[model samples]
Target: MEQKHGTPIEWLMPLAFCTVFGWVVWHTPAFILDFGPENQQLAALYARLDVSPGLAPLFGGYGDIIDYGALLLSPLIFIGGVMTVRRAPMEFESWRAIDRVAVFIGRITMMLIVLLTSVMIYEVILRYVFEAPTLWANELSLWLAGFVFLLAGLYAMQQRSHIRIFLLYDAVPRWLQRVFDVVSTSLIVIFAAALIYGGYGEAFAKFMRWETFGTAFDPPIPATLKIMVLVIIALVAIQAVINLISDWNAVPVVHTAADDIDQDELERLKAAVGNEGVGELDVTRGAIQGNQSEHK
Candidate 1:
């Protein structure tokens, strides 16, 4: 089966969602003032909290909604993007150890962020509407989000989706590309290994301390789970390194024989022909002959 590369839109969806979610979270107070003052649920909560009148306007009922909505949507978007890419025709290529590790870390982080954001959004909404919320949600979201941020490097490595100038890279000899791949992958592996070692201690310490959110919904969810994400990230980072090594020593492979033509070139061809889909060259010949006879 051919692996399908994700369309730009698919890749961008999670990014777009994260940006919007971040914006909403960052500006929750402002949004409340502008659009949510009329929400009775929010007003009542504000009143009960003994919040001053000046500050009351800053609280919005939709804070949870926005927060949770972003969280919920993020993972779905990520999953969708991954599945889309997975379906693309897979092409084997050589990669640097650093590059593979980076891609792996990047993928894991992306998934974690999306999932954590979703969990946060869910907890916030449940708390506001039902007068109850899950302790697990908060802790889960925090741990998951933390891992997501940490795993970014590994994911980037595995996917080989890191940003590069394809035009320049493509122009280079295959042997050189292989060399660059080795150098890049080696650096990534070293960096990720260091992060894993340092991160492990911090994660273990937190677990031992028995950290809790200190909210009504607080639960004794182990900090180890959060730390485990880093461990997994480390593994992914290593895997990426292995992948890079494998690719580095192998010859570069190209799956398709066709040239990649840009939209501009396609459009230029259309313009020259005056209309799109003129069909075979034989069809053009027939049309020209028909026009010539009509003139005669």
Candidate 2:
């Protein structure tokens, strides 16, 4: 398969992610600084509950502006993220910009999963082997894992890999399939909209207060995750819309038990099993391929 090459713009997504997360990891405390003890004027701006003296100047008195700016420019971010995944082979022929963006975020989410696993492993080693477990590891793992679950949903939606009963769907005509698609997408949109409407106030309050998970190594899981929930659901809704639009004209697909098998995964397993194990693998693979063809 010929790979689609992206332009210089493709670098924007990764660079943007690095910059955001890097800033977040480093300047988190700084953003919630309380300069009131030393400077009265700066205190008014940085005033918040549970704040301490820190490097507030790093944000140059425009932290909120920068955040709002990013929100306004999210469409560009979406385009950049989409472009980042264009070089790879796509599983869906109907994949569009939103699908690419979902996949890109999903890839990032996968990296976070690795980091989460590493954190757990380190915690285990310290608790058992050294008996000096860190205070932050468990909380950090929970934080990362939560986002992973949220983001993986977007990827699953794009890949159509989420759990679904396609028995009725597969038997439907093209027009009925389109109706189903529209109805499902509308429901998704409504759910997201309702969630955001109901939760935005609380999310905004927590974010403004810069709430933290009260622990020895206090982390702002509450504040960040509250906002994250709304953001992710919005993204998922956008993806659902894009999926409906992109797949509107696509040929109706038949789903079966064979659809549960991943050919690529079978190939990987076969490769890893080697020549001695090839016989049984060949039989299973051949059967799967035939079933796939028969379903088609």
Candidate 3:
């Protein structure tokens, strides 16, 4: 099927995400050093967030997610959502900028999950085997897990991995299916818009202040993540709009139990039973299996 991805300049969105990612990672230590009440410039810039317990907590309702280490990612993601109709080509070889960026984010998220798992394994070994538990592993895993979950939604939309209960809609006429698509996309847009409107003030406050986790690790996971939620949801809404317009004439995608079944797995299971992996017939019936070429 044909598709459309408007304008080549949409590369700006991915650039924003990457640039902020690089900036935050680079200047984290400096931001922490300057993030204090005495430094009027940094204090006013960072809002009411303190890196450690010595500082006062003002306008800090979130966890240890507001540190200077990871503050710029939120804004980068918001920039990624600036264009409501931008989309990636369906083909991997012909992917556009947004498609590549989404894939890049997905790979990073996967690495984070792997890192989280490794930390858990290391913690287990230290606690049970060495009998010396560490303080940072649990918080570290929690921090990575939060971003993994948040970013997974955006990747899912890019790959069309979302679940759809299509029983009624698939059975309906093409026109009716189009109507259902419109209604569903409209609901998603409305929900995302409502969340941004309600949470914008809080996210902005946390972002401007650069809050931090009160724990010993004290990473800036909260403020950045709060900002991320609004940004990613807006991205999701914009993707829905793009899908709504681009797939307007898409054919009904019928799904069934058989569709969900893995044919290769089924064949392997069939072979383990000592039966030749032929279709629907018994050897005891004295019927020779038909030739594969004949069936074709």
Candidate 4:
């Protein structure tokens, strides 16, 4: 399929996400330094808490210190969601820029795998070879894992990879399917709204005060993860809305067990593997055909 390129206006959501996440990634070193006790001015500028109406008791006695990381990431999470919602829903095989951003996110998140592996390898060397152990390795890996797991939801939503019960759904009438879509999307939006609204004060307080996980490698991971969750949930809801709008006029499709198999998949795989003479695998006849289509 030919890919459609949108105008400058359509590029805004993606650009916004890139800008915000980019800022956070770039400023991370400074952010960490800002939280250090030696840097009073930077700390004050970045992590000073708005003490009024704070949920101080929630943090187990640490007075509120603003969460710079969460604050920085909030815009990325939001703009990422907006970008997802703005994306035109495409088939799984079709490549588009909107989908490319999700893939971009997925690619970046793959860094966690590298981080986890590197951390474990370093820990092994430290413990076995150097006769030392570091608390930071495990915790840092855990921290990386948190973002990897959480950010995956956005990618899955873009790919429409979430598990669904299609037995009844696929067989429904077009109007009925639309109704189902509306109800489901409405529930998701409601849940996201409630989560944000109900937990706003709590998240705000935690992030505002720079709450720690209380480990030796004390990262503000908890605060950042919580905010990330809220942000992603809102984004998922927005994507659902976009899906509904995009799919509302579509015809309902009924699928049987047989429809689950696609013979062309094997052909594509063979082509990918550089098998020049490989032909389409005819699943029904259980044979490979020289031509792209099966002989009737």
Candidate 5:
């Protein structure tokens, strides 16, 4: 399939970077405030600072200014996200505007997973081969993995690839299918709202304090993950609504056992071992035979 060239990166990068820069400043205020004051190695770095050694949480007295700055910068994330989706392939026919946001987040999370793997590999090599381990690598991996898990949900929802038993759905008529979609979307919205309503206060508190995981590496996993959970759930809910609207007019689909098959995987297997090897494989042969007869 041909790929769509979305928005130019020249524009997207600067817009996305605005949010990234603001997030860095807002989320890791200690970096600019009074970070690691107890570490002797960082003493020279601290001494050169124009600000005081022990100040408020986020830039001490300048917290209000930083807050306003971050608020102003946060909207750039949405703008960048929308623009980035111009390049995303509409994998499903029912794709909609909200799907762009989910796909954008999913792409970023996929990159984070790659970075997480590299971090783990680097840690393993250093720990076993060099007999030296870093304190930050493990925590960093955990942090990235958490966000990956959370963000992947939104992507999965957008793709309609989440766990679903389509046996009943496939048997239903168009009107019933629409009813099912509405019911499921409503449940998702309710669940997301309940979760956010219950957890918002705590998430906000942890985020404001930049709560850490309290370990040698001391990452802000608690603070960040809490906020991410609510954010991802809200996105998932929105994507569910979008799916309902976009798929409303879609013809009723009759899912089957063959629907579960991964065509790309079969092709890859054939390429890897040639057609003869694929034919000899008993595992997939039955499914292929069943699919052929079903299609006939």
Candidate 6:
């Protein structure tokens, strides 16, 4: 019999790239001090973190952590990505279709967050300490930050931790909740699909020509990365479709009073006052009291 789930071959390239990149970075001093915008920002951050003279070496080595950590995680992410693609429920096939896009966007966002935060610090230090500013700092920050801002939506979808109001949702009946989930997820998928279809051509063209930020700090990082943004948008679109499918078949379980108010609630109440209530409040208490009062 054929296997129910099999690993995808597409993950190998990224996995290999991460492994080789990590090893070279770990071994080479040149890679650590490449002086490109990305590395410069990273180095500046390290310098700031070095408060004590003795800690300077440790702080300077922070870039290696990023390099090695990415190296280590890349393979795992690849494997997981494969598993996610292969083992993903048939009902959730839409997720597989768009998984790459979500990952690409998430990676870009994280890189931007790091780059911007570092450059902002670098600029502040230059202005305050040296009484001089660098053009590279501002340009670098903007370039990196732009990429990060673009990726946030993809990351939010991948993590499934996007903000949503759940307070009123608890009161919704199970079947209706499922319907709500399907509708919401479907809408997101539609929006993402539209974005990908409209934007992918331009994004791909940019990548094909090898566009650059035109900065002095480093060699042109390929515009191929921009393609990742398109890919991620596409993936998120697929994920939304899969989520809608999965949720359509899901049976929502009603939560009990105890679950509604737990230790966290007790802590909040205690912070507000000094005591805990003796028992859970009856949700139907007002109705019960009304019936008894009428009979009396």
Estimate TM-scores for all models.
0.41, 0.72, 0.65, 0.60, 0.72, 0.49
- Alpha carbon deviation, residue 1, candidate 6 (Å): 28
* Error at 273, model 4, angstroms: 19
Please give, for residues 76-183, the per-residue lDDT of candidate 4 as tens digits.
Answer: 665554344343334354344445556546544654566578889999999999999998888877877888787788777766678777888867777888888899
Checking candidate 3 for backbone clashes, the offending pairs are 46-209, 47-209, 64-213, 65-220, 65-221, 65-222, 65-223, 66-211, 66-220, 67-220
Give per-residue lDDT, candidate 5, residue 26: 34
RMSD of each: 16.6, 6.2, 9.7, 9.7, 6.8, 12.9
* Candidate 6 lDDT score at position 228: 57
Over 4 Å off, model 6: 1-112, 163-172, 213-226, 245-272, 276-296
Tens digit of per-residue lDDT, candidate 2, span 24-104: 532343344422124443344334421333433334542454443444455566565655565356455565544667777
lDDT of 2: 0.69
Candidate 3 global TM-score: 0.65
Cα lDDT, model 3, residue 188:
97
lDDT tens digits, residues 1-296, model 3? 12445444444444455445645632343454444334454444334333353534334522134333347465646445443334345433323445655655655565567667888999999999999998888887787788889888877776666887877976789998888889999999999999999999998777655666768765567777888899889988877776677677665554554554455676677788755555554322122223333676
- Counted clashes in each candidate structure: 43, 0, 10, 4, 1, 4
Model 1 bad stretches (over 4 Å):
1-139, 147-156, 165-168, 219-222, 249-296
Expressed as tens digits, the lDDT of each residue in 43-81 for candidate 1 is 443343322334333244334444445556755665554
- By lDDT, is 1 or 2 better? 2
Model 4: lDDT of residue 245: 74
lDDT (Cα, tens digit) per residue for candidate 5, span 1-296: 12474446624544454445535533454452343333443333334322344434444433344444555666676566555564435466455555677767766666567778999999999999999999999998998788789988988898888999888886778898889999999999999999999999999777656667778867778878998899889988988888888888886655555565677887887898888886645345456556667999
